[model samples]
Target chain A: MINNFHSLLTIMMTDPTNLLSLGWVDSFIIIVYFIFVLGIGYYLLRFTKTGEDFFMAGRKMTAWIAGLSFVAANLGSLELMGWAASAYQYGILATHWYWIGAIPAMLFLGIIMMPFYYISKTHSVPGYLKLRFGEGSSMLSAVSFGFMTVFMSGINMYSMAIVMKVVLGWDIHFSIWVSSITVMVYVVLGGLLSAIFNEVLQFMLIWLGALIIPIIGLIETGGWDGMVERISQNFPAGDYTHLWSTMGSFQDNPMGIHWTGIVFGLGLIISFAYWTTDFLVVQRVLSAKDLRSAKMAPIIGAGFKMMVPFIVILPGLLGLAVILPPLVGENQVSAMNPHSYNEVLPLMLARYAGPGLLGLGVTALIAGFMSGMAGNVSAFATVWTYDIYKPTHLKLSKKEESDAYYVKIGRWCTVLGVFVSIGTAYLVQQFASIMDYVQALFSFFVAPLFGTVILGMLWKRATAAGGFWGLFAGIGSSIGMWAWVKIYPGALKYIALSEHAKDMAENMYRALWSWLICVIVTVVVSYLTRPKADSELVGLVRGCTDIPSEGDLPLIKRPIFWASIVFAIFIVLNIIFW
Target chain B: MIENKGISIWFFIGSLLLIYGVAITIANVYEMISPSMEKQIVLRELNFGVWWGILLVIVGLIYFINFRPWKKGNNNKN
Candidate 1:
């Protein structure tokens, strides 16, 4: 499962037929792109100050910048490649995950969890937990956040490498190396600031390329009506038509994925944990200019989440229905056995996109992949340096060099993270549903952090002992059940284990179960322990409101941010007929 | 300090309405317009330099733009 997952990840990394296929124009275009990316990173480096600058982009991100960064982080190289693969493999049902899963989840997270965001204004989500619950809880969350990164970064990079090998005809190692080396160059140069700047560009660029293939495909096939007609004729409209159905012959079809699965099961749990609790989203909102900016960033993200179905999921199925028939046989469409649909979307892009614009599209995808890698590298470095390094080791009397050193080491850590994660990606390649594997592993850590942090802020009664024990209980049961589900496939296979099926241990990790168990353990532990001091809760609340007032918000952004989000939401509503 | 409450509230509402309106407009326009009409345009302009394509190219160019680390008057960084 892992090997197949890795192999299929790069299905869209490059075009197999275009091997050694460097045109003068393509070469020029590619060179220009490289110059711009490196240049942007270099320029953004100026924004780096003390450790905060390197780690949190100086906590000065505008809503526009945050929106772009969120979008970029939302997609990695694997996502750019995977959407095509998913669409081709599952028809339109791939989109349902975006609309049903991503859009509503992020929206609810923004509104429902605003109170939590208001209180825990720290660098990483674990840091917020620590602030809320005490040192022990924060430390626990930091460790879990670190673990989650290992799981997610590995899955993402590995999948991207798979696409490069399949699409670009590069050796798997070479793909991994090239991807790592290039992304590291900029990520190391500027840290999170560089990561965000580069990602904004990437988000726009990838979308440009991503949306292009479908429009062109639609043209080649006839149009939207043509697509629907072809889908109706060639495939069951039910499979291709619906966004929330369980279709696809590649893996186990778990029972927990029904309406209950979509809503109460995997959907509810992941949405609550990830949107409300996960530090990645939290980090972006925290970086906002103010409370208004913070709220705006997520609202915008929710809006874009809605468009993803149209932008990502529909194109792949359309590839299978409209474009893939003549160029590649069904055998080739299925690709090398176990039917690796991952590469088909990119392959279809190569097959369909006119040769003139092909280079730009390819370049855009490369940008998208690198941007995601950069986000992980930067994020991991931030947590390691801030939560682990500075807190643990040498203290500088002068804040300047200490800050400068953080800037320096933060960049170095990103480089280290890129290299380590690439290696980790290779290891993660053993799983099948690479995306699911990453998410499930994330869920294990995500929900516990959510539970601990929320309680830490709202309930002064939350205890450090409770925080530690709760984390252990939540994460421990997640991993344990994962092992059980993997070996047995017996009663609990219904879990899909949601994300675990995609990881190194294919078919465990059940996101919902992990969250439930984690919350239960955390609450029970908190209940068992002494209540937290009142002063600590007050401090956490004060910190949340303090920074946003003077530093970032200038009144101008307030309107722009709100406007952008409202627009984004409208886009969401129209796409899924929601 | 800069309490232009009226302006701030107006901008907030205006920005929200515009952004949301645009997002909804594009989506709605796409739906309202015949898919066949879109198909005709998309097919005719496979290689034609549409504004969308041009805009995409321009956006890519912006990513590559190089600025000196300490350019004379770039206050945005601070």
Candidate 2:
């Protein structure tokens, strides 16, 4: 019976094509992580009695907790693996995603935008839209956000399974079922509180597990200077080590992007859009205990976000420098050189980590994926319950539901959302390219929504008609541009405005165009329509709102002070790398 | 974070790290003693498992003691 059980367990868990196998020590650590997260959810269940507690964590998180959770929610395995792969493919140009592409926008959200969001007491980003714009704009935002969140969640699920299959030889079905069920249980039981707690845990686990890669790699390659020398020696055709020196011309860099595209398109539009408007990340800040904590959270997040490249990008650089036989792209992968660029982080992990550390690394990846899915599902539940279901239900029935009733709906939505995501995951598994389109679909909404939200907050003269039409026009134009490129292969030069621009450059330029169209349409429409009264716009718009001072204790205590420090560091890092 | 009144997150992290650290350390030491059972890993000569495990144990102990539930008035609820 014991031998039969052992064989059954092995058959259920392991895949035949796996490149690495975990020892018992590694397996034990993974088991502990699952139990730890589930235990947190189960333990927190009693505290999650009300809708606010379930959906917003009762707004009692400190800056550190909320900050770490905010960063961790975006620090998914997909983000890690994908960016690491990009580092190997495009070199240190990929660091722009973490640095210029992220830090400035994150600081902007904390210092400039958090006041509007916090003072408004909105539950989600669309909730803010309803107050500033109207029901129509809010509904549009909520529906698109809801749909995209679940779709992305499913993609994360599918990606996790694939990673597990490739790295650990786990069966895809087993990986999917186990991880999905685990996420569903915790999320349903405790909701956002559960998600936030797990996110914080995931953040720590990620650092502990993955930080070793860069440390070991640096030791192996002599150090940063040594790694740079080795990488430069290997790829002398293009400057791969310098961040900004080669960005003057598209042909000088591996990414085929101009500095303007990096600065204006990504650094300005895309980064601000995703960081400020996306409810998935903003919801973490909204869980802060007070206005000050809310204001401080993203700044703290920005500081840590700067350091992530060491673990993520450095390993990829090390791979380019030292890994033998070379990692190839998916199309070029074969039985002999089976690893693809997507497998860079895992390949590095397999190279350095032994039994005990191997478990930690795998656990970190699992934690990252599960937390990412949880973030998506929890955001979906909030939007569905608060934005879509509640408003629609009340408008039709003309009755206000109790908070408990909505909390119950939120719980049910969590379950339903998980099931939908699982179904979507299976669907994506059948047609892998669906994942790319799903990610593109996310970009379509975010850039446009940023225009709507920023205009709504900064310009009091912006009317409801303007907000709605601007969002509609922005999304429509983004989709149109995407389809244009799809239909006409030559349209890329027209859209990105340079023949040298690659797919990544095209995405940035497209976001910039969609945002401009949104702003222009909004400006024209707002001038044509009557505006909201200043009294009505008090907490929603910048000029009309009375901003509260966070109170001066010391320069060191202020969010702005830390933000300035982070900004200074940002500029210095850019200059040093330049 | 208020829900953490039952148990602090730090304490939980500490407990898990301590457990893992000790396990890894013991596993590494046993392999060192028995030489034949050790798996070939990169930088194995560095004895990373021993030192890293010890570091984890020390950090974990600090967190575990500081936030342990049984300690007097140890609830670090935000």
Candidate 3:
């Protein structure tokens, strides 16, 4: 593992020139970005007089900003490196999430889940759960989610720290500490508002700077047509030539079936969690000007998701055309070494993006890392505030002093979350592939609750017993499968899956199935056992709304009506064209 | 609490559909334009027209597949 890490370190820093050239202008842009983020966050801080203001942007985030922020938040440290690697490695197939995962999930969330979420407007998912399962359940959830925040923050730190080390020619530990502290300052000073504002800045930087990278990669191959031609020679199989199949090399086998599972399964489960549940994302919507605005956040984010192929994915594929030649010889070989996979992007940026563009890309890369780290810190703060702090103080008054104290606590939570995560980053398995691993880990917490929260809102009979059982069952099933994969050879070897596929399924499907089990248990157990009385239920029923409701107008009548039609059109199109 | 006076439901739906359509389209288009692997056939198992046709049919059928309408005035007034 140490040797593996060393090789990765080697590949990550293959280009000394890109490292050397990064200087004052790049530093200036990063500092400017820091100030810009801080300016907006602190400026926005004036509007935050109470806990709600600090936590949810006073629940008045505009639709476009909210939408863009969701994308920004979703686009974490991994894309700063991973997507670029994926592009060079897998071709268009590297980005299947935009279709099978993202598109469906967004529509599902907006149409199916968001309306309900907006109606049952709470500060956090656990707060939503608290309405359903009572206090104890919320606490358990807080613990699990808190774990996720730490784990995810660690991952963000780990990946960005690697990039920092690679690009800045610094030591890895130094890189990790520096990256963590840099992200911590602004996020700690502010909160989600700071995270959200920086996301907007970071995303635009990612776009204008990162998008041009593929062009340079393509240029090295002579142009798009030439790049396509070279890949065609290597990958001549059916659907292989098609737009989505991927321009992969058989000799190299960049990603196999497991890789496919990684793309698709995560889309179904963990990716859904990213889009729907995470506070960093949902909070973006939570801060919306209205429910209408909130609904649009993911939709707008999908726009960026769809376009990312040009910036992040294509470069990875183009790297097959450009960089892979030097590493693997003309015949291409297994991308077993994680660093080799990781280097796919950095090498392209070094070789192709010259001088001014290089500076911009470096700035954007830092901005992207900042956006990711900021989201993690702010999200960690959120869980700390709502679940751990505010709920325990029964006598906590709504006075100005009390509210300010809550906001202060929230900010400090951000600081603690960042520092702790930086320390933990060294241990995370997904250090090499941050987004996929971190998000899948998040699903372990988020999925079990999806069943619990939705049921609590709809089923008044959903007993605390059922909630506990459901949460327990979901976590148990997921963890059992995870352990089985790791310990039981018969389970894993006979499973005949790639490490990537198993990991992806462990993250996505295991949690989804667990959630399904928990949902069934919640309903059946609630029905079988004595139900909560009408008086005991804390939410609106029948025509009466306001069970943590956001008060946004419905996005469309019979939303599934359009959603199904959309699904049908694509299905038929795929059948006919192939 | 703000009043629910100004709203555009189709805009949201349209935006999501456009996002879905465009992103998936690129994946398909990129698949079409690029190669699969060295040892495999070059034609896509899932093509643009087929994918679109099936999608259109599903969208068409979704209008009819019949789901319970989320009732109006379902406010959260606890």
Candidate 4:
């Protein structure tokens, strides 16, 4: 065993840079965290007796727990590292992701979309399609979602392993195996219950552990103004500090996109598609105890999510202003230039945190990655069991399976999903470019799926044929656009409407076009095809469904009230940062 | 307080924070008492661990008390 471990370490230590040295105190904290999460899984195991319990946390999470989990599910290590890197590379413009790219979409999900999802009583987003459109669209979504989740989980795993290798000199294979096994054990044991509980915990850990970096950093840099001045001194050619002032043209900002792309592409299409349609996050809210909690979950999530930039972006800005040697981009990283933009967060942690605090910081990252893996695997298991396996096999077999049987399948599927993710991690390691493409593929379905789901919920005239064809067309066009750029690089100017447009701009515009195509196709096709009867659309469509009242609680107690307050803050934050 | 039966999630979060806080404070105190003759990180003299630990402990204690695992009924008021 010792010899094998040594060989594995030798083989997997690809990154020569080892930036962190954890003391015994730090190791203890990490060990304690691992043990505590596993304990929570075991403690919740008894409660996860039925399929509902396993898949939906017995539908009993409060708004606070579910809300935090909703945000935490998306707050993976990759997001933190990537956004911080973006901050270093693109300046305060990167904050657009957390603020404009996320807040409005999250509020929309809470105020507009939650009622449809909660009232429909669907197990998954694809399940909602099964109700609204038919089996064809549902199966397409389920199969695509299954592939996306597993691949995305693998990408998260690979990213975590790389971070560990770079920062702590841990073996990639060892990190992969240990994290996969831990996530598998907990999720298989307790399913979504374990995932949600751990997500909330991860959320707290991320805040506490990472909040120190910006705190110490701001103090060292003499506050926001000092940091901005230092950044300007370091690089005066670019407008990295201001948000909107530099967004008039693609050349004005480092991100190489106009305000229209930021507002329409990212803000409207990608954000709404993700926040409203992604089952990984929606599952958390679906587990809420009631409709009010369901609505409030995303509202509360938006409130906290708006604050994430402080820990993520501020640290990168601090690193740029205060660190002696500027960090290089990923392409520029080499033996001579050892520091990459992605290393900013870990580097900040190493610089600012003492031994014990360092351990906590590392734990926070581990928790983030693990929660992300759990979120993906659990969602995959749900879709696979409910939308894929049951529909394709069980219904055909005509077997009356027990709820416990389905729960057992969910457990086994979670294991299978983790194993598949491990395989994908190895696959990603072999071809680095596949990781980028796989991540892009995850988004290819989002905008189109959002179009179909939103249309099905709001428009009773949308036919089943229109829904499936529209989704198919949108997904096809998105992939076609991506291929157009890849095959003909010059086409990007046409697609993004500027020669200065970059990959980020390409993504936003792609989502926008795909969503528009989906809507147009659905509208055109619905006019040609036979529409579903209004009677048939009873509980699913807006005009036919009688929306449930969330109670005449005092004005302050309503979700819309809180949502309004959060939206006001969102607007205020944009202006302040602008 | 998922399902209002198991331990409150707040209590669980608080307990973890309190333990980490206490451990960090102890380590901070130990390091301060016997300064190591090595290069230190930024703001080591500021005793960030001590103060951050204390803050975490105080907040953790508040959550722990309000939604104590020992008191089942005082949870999930939302």
lDDT of 3 by residue, A1-578 (tens): 43443344345454564343442233333444445555555554554567776777667666666777777777777775776665554556555655556666776666556655675667777776676567877888887787787777787767676667655565677667655776676665546655676676677668756765665456457786787777776555523223433323322334444433444455565566556666667767777766656656666655556566678767767766555343332244455422365666666666644323444566677677777777767777887787877776644755334777878888788777877787678766334566565665566667776667666666666788888788778777766766676676456433334343434334555655677788888777777778666765534222234433333536363334445555565455334322
Best-matching candidate per lDDT: 4
Which segments of candidate 2 are over 4 A away from where they belong? A1-17, A335-338, B36-38
Model 1: DockQ vs. true structure: 0.07
Q: Which runs in model 3 stand beyond 4 Å of their true positions? A: A1-20, A216-225, A234-264, A324-339, A395-401, A426-443, A457-461, A493-502, A505-507, A533-578, B1-78
Cα-lDDT of candidate 1:
0.58
Write one digit per residue (lDDT tens) for candidate 3, span B3-41. Answer: 222122222222222333333344445545674342131
Docking quality category of candidate 2 according to DockQ thresholds: medium
> Considering DockQ, where higher is better, how would the candidates rank from best to worst?
4, 2, 1, 3
* Poorest lDDT segment (10 consecutive residues) of candidate 1 chain A: A247-256
Q: iRMSD per model? A: 12.1, 1.8, 13.9, 1.6
Better of 1 and 3 by lDDT: 3
What count of clashes does model 3 give? 68
| Cα lDDT of model 2 by residue, B14-69, tens digit | 88889888877877776667654444767877777677778778988998898888
Query: Tens digits of per-residue lDDT for model 4 on A541-572?
Result: 88898877767688887999999999999999
Candidate 3 residue-wise lDDT at A546: 41
